[model samples]
Target: MKLNIAFFGSSLVSSYWNGAATYYRGIIRALAERGHTVTFYEPDAFDRQKHRDMEDPSWARVRVYQPTEEAALAQLKEAAKADIVVKASGVGVLDEWLEQAVLEYCGDSTTIFWDVDAPATLARVKENANDPFRELIPEYDMVLTYGGGNPVIDEYTKLGAQYCQPIYNALDPSTHHPVEPDSRFSSALLGFLGNRLPDREARVKEFFFKPAQQLHDKQFLLGGSGWEDVAQTIPNLDYAGHIYTRDHNAFNCSPLAVLNINRDSMAATGFSPPTRVFEAAGAAACLIMDYWQGVEQFLEPDTEVLVARNGDEVTAHLQNLSVERAKSIGQAARARVLAEHTYSHRAEQFEQIMKAERTSRAYV
Candidate 1:
């Protein structure tokens, strides 16, 4: 089932302010490993190219285009030639134009709209009856997502998608694994690494900020862009600006424990676990996620992962957490993800689904 895959995504070489970098890397790399050819078409916007953390990967061809509607449509035309053309959400440049344009090239290629932020997209569609993307949902051959399990799948189906699959975030072990604890990131009792976004700021205030305020004796670390101002507001919290994918292992491992807080829409939508969860677990760091509905699907609570419902519970987990316990839980999470949640496993699932789809289409 070798196919030429053209993936239209954000930045593939950088993780600067893009949270989906790891997710895109894991899936694309694994797909390439399975004998698929991938050409990653990304717009050269948002300074991602300027702050790129890695070279163009050997597994995929990297094509950087100008960040304009004309340039994007040119790339879109190029993408239409591939066996599977994927128009991922949040390309950050002329997104609406690309979304509609890809559908216009529909007959020859297997078109897919891969939504990295399904809950947000669904909410926007539900809020506005006349959103253009909502009307275009069922036009794609298939729909895939970052996470959101059944909740997302059901919504996409209701919107008339012929096929919908939730590819939950999984670890790329080679990229993120246990590294020697570095002093630059050390001495933190708790650490979190995510860009400060509007929908997530309030949750961060409740989970990350308030916990740091309550546990003044403990060291706290915050990483990512746009938190420089907020970082100064907390005395006990250290701000590590823009943690790159290369340093994610140290960011996850140096702390006593790492926290995963879902954005407002994802938290409300329930089954959506962001890439940070798997990245921390891949680094063999003890993970404590803000409680969401599908926690048990990936890892068991209190054993593989600690579920925190509120700031008080997060504080309680930190206070009662022993070094030995942290090690045990970290190891358990690492083992769990490696066995059932690695990118290789995810790639196989994707390949199988595509194979099934192709087979069914052949019958027709």
Candidate 2:
């Protein structure tokens, strides 16, 4: 049966400005490829004029919503007709009341809370013990996490969620693949592009900044927002500000090696590889990642990726590794991602999960 799904997510689908939109486009397109009808509902809070990437593809239908009660109610009415309703995490436009209202409109359709940031969400829930939504976990049919392995699932299940699963991040080969290296940023030792992670700042310093400082001959580039005022003793570290999503491959190619610093929550949860890992790998750039529990599961150490335990380890890799060896590792990682991790693979897993849910409901 062809399933009709209502996907409520943050940001305009047409404007692939953020990482969330990239995720949306990948999964939604994959779903469409599998013969599913997806109606994407996005709140127009951000400026649509500032779209930094490609326009919406022809596969999925998009619906824009307003903040008013009438607009939300109307969208809810339309959503009720779908076989499944997925309220993605971090729908920034909707207020708390609207989120609750959307959940309440589950009415015969399977309601899934697709949490993109499980660590942050879990952290918030833990901090707010009195939050009513904490208890609302059990009400949803299932809770889906973008990444975070067994630990995340166990935590969600313990928090009263009926079922929880990790979808995991994967590369979109169509968008990210072996690209011609950009010569401008090619001489840099390490390049990191990620938003502010307060808890993981230490890890960033240890694995990235410190190493760049130690190797004064090598340059380090930092991309993404919220680092203008952060104190940096390292004169070699260059801030690139925010790089657009479309230009990510060039940014990755510009650096001889890219640095991936997992947020503290993601590292603690385990098996949570961010989108940048796949993106960098897909771009065929050597990746130096901070040590994490499930690092081996996604990328093999020394073979597919270089594992950096501390600033010293990072510096050692930068100084010891030749450009030829780094390129070989990058190629291997790209091959691994192309074979095992992609949006198509994720879509297949999603179908299996939904099928299980439907079958179980039928028996009940």
Candidate 3:
């Protein structure tokens, strides 16, 4: 069937300063390349001008909706026109009433609660009994996750999610390929982008900052937003706030090694790898990541990726690996991602899930 799809989220169609937005852009574009018509809906409240990160995707049509109750209701009504409607997590603008309205107005449309941040969403639902959207989990035709593996599936299913599938983050080779090495952002040990949850912030300090502080002679670079006030007291520490998505390859190219840190919940629950990991690896930058459950599924420890459990391990990896060895590891990781973790692969999985859900609904 030729599906006309509409994606609803906080910042999909729009280029928001979040990984979910990138995921949305990549996956939707891939889906469009496969011949699906996808329309994206996002709020216009955010500063769309600061979107220096990604190019205006040519594949999908984007519509920025008004950020008012009446306007949201209007969007819901418009969404009813599509064959499939996807409500992604972290639309920052959605409230209980908005979520309820999405369910109420999505008449005959296959609705998907695509939880990009499963751990965070589940935590919210657990804490609030009055959260109206909690009861609507199972109401959706299917649930799609960005990274969480089995544990996330169990949590959502326990909360009455009928069907859940892990979509997982993937690499977009066109945008993230190895570039000529540069020295501007180069470091013997470096870290790139992220700042949201305090837990992740702390992990970055533990895994990256502390190590940099300890290895006084080694250089470290930090990228991403919300770190403007982050104290840069250490001599080796360098802060590059908010690198655009388009410059990700150039930024990664400069780093002899890059650090990857997962959120505390993701690390504890396991199987969640942020897009940055693949993004860095896609650029063939050596990755030194914190120890997380299911790290092996994506890359082998010590070979494909350097695993760090503490500051000491991180320092050791940076000190021990030669540039040639680091480059080789990065190259291997990049090959793995290109082979298994690309937006095209993700879109294929998404198509399969939609097809299976449609067939099941027919029988029901």
TM-score of each: 0.98, 0.93, 0.95
Candidate 2 local lDDT, 1-364, one digit each (tens):
6899998887534333355766777788888988999998877666642553556668888887785677877888899899999888887766465557767776689998899889889988889998767977888889998888888898898899999999888888887776776665666778988766577688877777788778888788888767776526667888877777777898887787898988888877878888889988998889988888888888899999998878899888988888898899999999998889888999999999999999999999
lDDT of 3 by residue, 250-302 (tens): 78888778888888888888899888888888999888898989999998888
Q: Where is model 1 poorest over a 10-residue stretch in terms of lDDT?
A: 98-107
Could you report the Cα RMSD, in angstroms, for every candidate shown? 0.9, 2.1, 1.7
Clashes of each: 0, 1, 2
Which segments of model 3 are wrong by more than 4 Å?
13-16, 52-55
User: What is candidate 1's lDDT per residue for 1-364, written digit by digit as tens?
Assistant: 7999998888899988788999999999999988999999999999999999999999999999998888887887788889999989998988888888888964589999999999999999999999999888888899999888898999999999999999889999999999998898889999998898999999899898999999998899999899988999899999989887889999999999999999999999988888999999999999989999988999999999999999899999999999999999999999999999999999999999899989998999
Superpose all Cα atoms of candidate 3 onto the true structure and report the RMSD in Å to 1 decimal: 1.7
Overall lDDT per candidate, in order of appearance: 0.92, 0.82, 0.81
lDDT: the better of candidates 2 and 3? 2
TM-score of 1: 0.98
Residue 253 of model 3, lDDT score: 80
* Ranking of models by TM-score: 1, 3, 2
Q: Of 1 and 3, which scores higher on lDDT?
A: 1
Looking at model 2, which ten-residue stretch has the lowest summed lDDT? 11-20
